[model samples]
Target: MTTITRILILMLIAVVSPIGAQDFQGIATYKTHRDFDIKMDSTKMNDAMQKQMMEMMKKQFQKTYLLTFDRSSSVYKQEIELSKPQVGGGFQVSFGSSGSDVFYKNVKHKTYVDQKETMGKKFLIKDSIAPIQWQLQSDTKHIGEYICFKATYTKQVPKVNLNFNSKPNIGDENEEEKEPEMEERIITAWYTPQIPVSNGPAKYQGLPGLILEIHDGKLTVICSKIVINPEEKVGIEVPTKGKEVSQTEYDDIMENKTKEMMERYAPSRGSKDGAIQISIGG
Candidate 1:
């Protein structure tokens, strides 16, 4: 059948079928993966070492998240797992979002509360949800048992500079610094109307249905399983712990911290023995 015909049939079924309880709630499990390629100086690092590093990076990027939602509110959080010891080289790198952070969204109020911890400090980021202008498409696909419709949004995001070198750059002192570049990216989401809830993993929502899959840049989030109305009702609580701050304030704090780290670990001039250079592409 055509996509339009399929949608019509689903709408008919929904009209004829008996409606469930009014207090709708569900738990969705999502698996996330990012595709990245790392390049390092061949002279400093051997093929075996690079291979080991790639394996470690892969483990870091592969993570799972759980979203518990009622009718108007939802809580999305990463699944906590035991940290494994870093092997291979003596160098260890830890980056990206923390596993303990919690994201809470209230679609009815158009607000979000993100509880995050960084630099041994906890912050509760409270802010209004930035509206996304989604262009709903007629394309349809089946994700597991649910038929999903496609939606897309375009936005400009900061371009990532992944070149890292343990060698200081020697440039003219009179040269002016350039502003950070921005690039446009299209975010694609596949939502299932069967769920009939405006909830999704992370900060993405505002859809007519629950999002089953998302393609944001190089990262992909796919719902692996969903349980609707379990025996024990899930409680959605607003986080109270941490110093409250706006989303912009939290972003500024993180940016300053990152700059500090870069300055501290930046390589000195005339360094050769332990110099390491890495470039990443996605």
Candidate 2:
């Protein structure tokens, strides 16, 4: 063959078979840790007139979540943990995905206490559930060499409508007029696609990369390390529950019980045990 013909053939091969394809089946790792101050919204609390200076203390609440993704099969596995003190607690959930459908198993642990109240008997318990619907929210962006993406996701929490029994009642059937205190924490997550997994620790997922950090205002959960695409297939199991109840009913029960407990435990007229007490009618 002529020299020109040889050059043309080589050019044709180069054009057809591109060199160095993207690594769509490799593992990615990420880790980050930071501190945050926690407090209730001033707008939600009563007694706005008396501005109380809240102190900032170091609260140790950390978590570790492990994730494994297989891009070839589109399946992912996650293990989450909650590490905290006696007053506060943590929970864990395991989830995996096959195609568009996802499956989950959740386990949560908390300090348990039972007592009687005006509303009824109540229990303070902890539980966790997993494998909710999660989708990719955005494309990957580069933060230095590492690609990242900010994706917003949601978890449908049960309605929490708890009445405040600690407040004074005007009359019978007048409870509706009084204002109740409650708030629904709508959670959103930012993930990175560098990991290429649809699974995240707790209820966080659906970003272009691993979730380095997440906050629901009150408590913040961050990823310390993420190991992606392990060679062996990981098994995710649904955890056994110590206390089982739907998300909606659980909040409702807690609210009523807390209010009743406050009323009974707190000093009403002139006792220091209550959250607020006033000496009157002496």
Candidate 3:
């Protein structure tokens, strides 16, 4: 065929293809898991005790989330589990924040509302996605059936605390405050242009195409299944039945609540009352 004939055929295909990525709607299910590198001094507990603790931590970190998105907006939330009876009520530690967060994002508008539930209290956190300067690399890989590109960025993150014995004073105005230590966290994401829209799990977005996998060293969320333009369209709604708060305000609320819990249980620290306490990270 002549060169002119090939050019005309390409133009015709473009006219027939879908014009907008947002027009295609689907749900992507992701399964998340975390890794813990803990050096437990080795002398404090025997090998058997350490193994048991690891098993419990694994159960707590494994979670599943579903992201339902159309061309412009998407809603991502966790799959809740049925309530089960606990064997023993004691100190339990989770790798991530102890909250079930529901994120609603409009990709075109660049806005989001996070419906966060912490300690049975609801918070509607309205905020925009933070602009991340990702350094796009030439490396390409496939996440599922779609081909994805690589990007990386670094941010300063607060050091996580899972202390079960911290005692914090409530409403103490004269108490001197100490700044919490911060560390640099590197985030990497893989996105596919084949999917078209810019969306991902959690607070990640602004990529050329939809993000298929993302990781922040400790935890990773990978797309396990994707259904495109199903028979029934998933409803994307902003959560309203929660106390309205900005992202900063929500963090403050969580911090204060955590302090209250630590002080409430401070007296039980190291007490040999035949109670069980399990902690994962140092």
Candidate 4:
């Protein structure tokens, strides 16, 4: 059967289902993995050092997150874990502070509030949820015990320059630098009607059912486990501890910060660079 037909059936089932307590909550565990390729100056980094860097990057990007949701609202955050310090060549590799941010979404109101921390400053990013025009596909699959249907959406995102060569080109200083071009990216999601909740990990929502898996660029988020109406009820609270800013303002700040960081770490002309450079692409 087509996904749209299944969705209609699920909606009918939900309408006729018995109404219990007003408080209905669920907790979903999601594991995320991102693939990255690191290009470094071979002279500064040997085979062993490169392998170690790759391993560290893998560990850094492989993370688990928990989504606590009700009928109208949800909160998504990373599950923290303690690990031994990773240091190489007098530099320490650490996870981004944004990982600890709390992302709260209200599907009923089409709003989102994200608590973000960057450069020792806190910001509350409040904005309307950007709607995704998903095209439901006829393909179906199984995620654990749940049957999932495929849906896809295309978006334009800033293109990331993955050219990690630190060397300067001749006459490159005279050329005017252009803004990063936008590229089309397809996001694929697998959602199950069995759960009957319009929620997902991170900032993804608005689907007919709970999103069990998502493929966006190099990152993949998959639901590991789900508990419905657990013994402990989930409470989602809006974050209010940061300076308020719109999502676009936050993006501008981050983009400038990234440019500053790149300039700071960029190799100086005619200098012996011993630092390791790692680039994580989305």
Candidate with maximal lDDT? 1
User: Where does candidate 1 have its weakest 10-residue lDDT segment?
Assistant: 273-282
Cα lDDT computed for each candidate against the true fold: 0.80, 0.37, 0.73, 0.79
Which stretches of model 3 miss by more than 4 angstroms? 1-22, 38-46, 83-101, 161-175, 267-270, 277-282
Cα RMSD of predicted structure 3: 5.9
- Model 4 local distance difference test score: 0.79
Ranking by lDDT: 1, 4, 3, 2
Model 1: per-residue Cα lDDT over 191-215, one tens digit each: 9877877779998998878999999
Clashes of 1: 0
Candidate that beats the other on TM-score, 2 or 3, i.e. the better one? 3
Mind sharing the TM-score for model 4?
A: 0.88
Name model 2 segments beyond 4 Å from true: 1-146, 153-173, 177-188, 207-210, 229-235, 273-282
**On lDDT, who's better, 2 or 4?**
4
**Higher lDDT: candidate 3 or 4?**
4
Better of 1 and 2 by lDDT: 1
lDDT of 3 at 12: 57
